[model samples]
Target: MLTHKGDKSGIRSDFISDYDDLADQWWDPRGPLAPLGWIARARAGFIPVAGHEQARLLDIACGGGLFGPHAAGKGYRVFGVDLSEMSLREALRHGFDEVVRADIARLPFDDESFDVVTAGQCLEHVPDPFGVVAEACRVLRPGGTLVVDTIADTKVARLVSITLAENVPLPGRPPRGTHDHRLFVNRERLTGVAREHGVELELLGLRPRLREMARYAAGRLEEVRMVRTKSTSVLYLGVGIKK
Candidate 1:
């Protein structure tokens, strides 16, 4: 049986509720969560999974199990954790190896238990991102990989990703307030937090392909690409290696 520890004290109940409400749509490639699938693919590309086929991966906030299947296909023994039972059910339906409903800030795992830990598009929704990172580090073994991706904390990011992409009411767009500008974490802040946990951080920016963006707006999932860019002013992916 999967162990679930910790209360939801440090978590944002509203955020969990929001995700639970959308749990059914999470796996819909042509739905509001299309961007998340693309983001998960891009984030997975950055992790150096070669020569570690037996490695164990823990995906925090693994809503609908987007990244879990991808990681599992790459031969990692994958486990996912989230706070929403509805979301966990969705993830399980997608055939993830293991899905547990638990708080990210208080992960139920032994120290140095995982070879890879990921928190994609999750930090922004949590009330305590630093606490989540600390727990991720605690669960990661020495030299393990830690992957995270989030909207950058910047004016352009607010204008493009949140205000426009989420609230503009375009086709396939997410609901309003899907993101809170104030909770967005920038590269510097995330790196600092990772460093505090004895992990060296590297930042990578994800730039949307205009054509792909248009296809996404039209609810088409084909050839959706979010490639690396020189600027992380909008969306960014980070990699950390535990020491």
Candidate 2:
């Protein structure tokens, strides 16, 4: 994994500002934020919650607490962290058990503080994804699980997820420039980072329901569906087991 010095000054100020501007839309299923909610719900399916009823979970860059309530419902003690105060406030208003404003790369918790750590659709927004992954692992206890999902670095992903989804100006689509194509991460790199942090990684591809994508764009989150796939050319999910 890549190492960085000092605090999380490497994080982009503009990214936080952008999320802050959209904080109010987080819970609106029919809003441009529905896609994130969809992704969060889909990713939640992969978490091993059956025997972890009392596990502590920390979601880094947990904008609007998308995964917070769901994880809590599964009996996990959930905590969320984000750089945007507005986002954190929205998360609190949405009933997150705990929400903290902090940098993803410089988490406020102590080492081995959590039984599970998750960062969903967040790596692409940071300047140093590897550093963030290391930080996630740092706070996880031995045998804990670390989950992550991010867009893939591929031409198709750029053209579809970024160019079309962001810049097309379609109704319900997120505002343009919401994503930076250059920051997309591939499965190999993500798993490599986890491996370096003493975590065994498993990579999976996310195949969002096509019909659900349309529903999400139309702000109908209840109608969206997501499925797992073997192809990681568009989006990928990962689960790392800390040793």
Candidate 3:
């Protein structure tokens, strides 16, 4: 992860500013964050419907509420937390029941408070993503589910997620400095951290459906679908239940 210093790629180390700067682009299909909207739909598929009334879900680093609409009709009161003020404003304007301006590394809720917790596309930006995982788990109740998605720390991840993804002139290409490969999460350590916090995680590889990507690139499709894959060398999702 980030070592509190600049990386070898010469990209700026302050990643949070990007969210604030790109707040308006969060809902644009051809914007940098469009892929996040696609991933949000995939993540929603893993969440079972609420079994009881007032089931609570905490969405960490919820930028512009990309996960909100997909999470609706699931019978949960969604709460979002992010450090970006402008992003939180957009999140509140979306479907989040409540929005809190807070850092993911230091969650403010009590232990076992939320029935579910989700951290998406945020861990890779921190100095200690595992610590953020622990915080996510801390607020998650026993029998609660925890879902997270992030880029894996590997040469292939750096090549695809950062190099080609950012530099290529694609429809959903993120800003050039949006990713720092040195801060990518280690898959093994991620699972271990969740297990240590009483959650046994199941990791799944995820990527855009190639045909859908092509259609989206051609402007024939407004959105592309993310599908499961056998490889987790790059972007991946994790789902687990608290033991």
Candidate 4:
């Protein structure tokens, strides 16, 4: 797990390799796996924003092709892109329409190639989030949707170093091999970047209904503790649109 961030280290490439290595075990939803549940939940959050079956879609950092193929199943023409061939192969195995090897900084597609573009759990690992968003904007049609989900920079996220990501094992993930980042996006940062990139930002709040109760309780009441724990600890999702 190469956690070292470097201009020369092919960090993206290495990250892809790491996921590719775990591709087979990546999608299984039943395990005590942290990433699987998160991915599924993120995909569910994305579907409503993704629009209908007729839309042509591109999923960046598609990993094992979670949302893309599911969208394809719903009647969209879906293309998935990732930095790892190994992960793309798993996506192909699951019947994604197209899987390409590319970087989000510079997508290998013509302008306005997709009606909707989605990225799940990838932004945090990306070195240049603005660059990635710019490419997503460039490749989407004027009214296309860009949906993204990433690890939020909450106090809980700080504890990520000690807490096994609900998906990572008890042994903890190799440093830099998993979430390799110092900062995760907050709503303000996401909005700022989207504005800079010529996109309309929408902060799609993702906390479950119970989470509100929890925030009300933390250190104050026991019932509230449940809600606070889930709310603060849960991954946040946001959506931005290309106008």
RMSD per model, one decimal:
4.7, 5.0, 2.9, 6.8
C-alpha lDDT values of all predictions: 0.79, 0.78, 0.90, 0.61
Model 1 regions more than 4 Å off: 1-17, 50-54, 218-223
**Which of 1 and 2 is the better model by TM-score?**
1
TM-score of each: 0.88, 0.87, 0.94, 0.72
Which regions in candidate 3 have their CA more than 4 angstroms from the true location?
1-18
lDDT of each residue in 134-173, candidate 1, tens digit only: 8998999998899988878799988987668876776557
Model 1, 100: alpha-carbon shift in Å?
1.4
lDDT ranking of the models: 3, 1, 2, 4
Candidate 2 lDDT over 69-184, as tens digits, reads 66756667778999888889887766577888888889999999898898998998787888899899999998888989998989999898877887666455676556667678
The true-versus-predicted C-alpha distance at residue 108 of model 1, in Å, is 0.9
* Model 1: worst 10 consecutive residues (lDDT sum): 1-10
Q: List the residue pairs that clash in candidate 1.
A: none
Residue 217 error, candidate 3, Å = 0.8
Number of the top lDDT candidate: 3
Reference-based TM-score, model 4: 0.72
Q: How many residue pairs clash in each candidate?
A: 0, 1, 1, 6
The residue pairs that clash in candidate 3, if any, are: 1-183
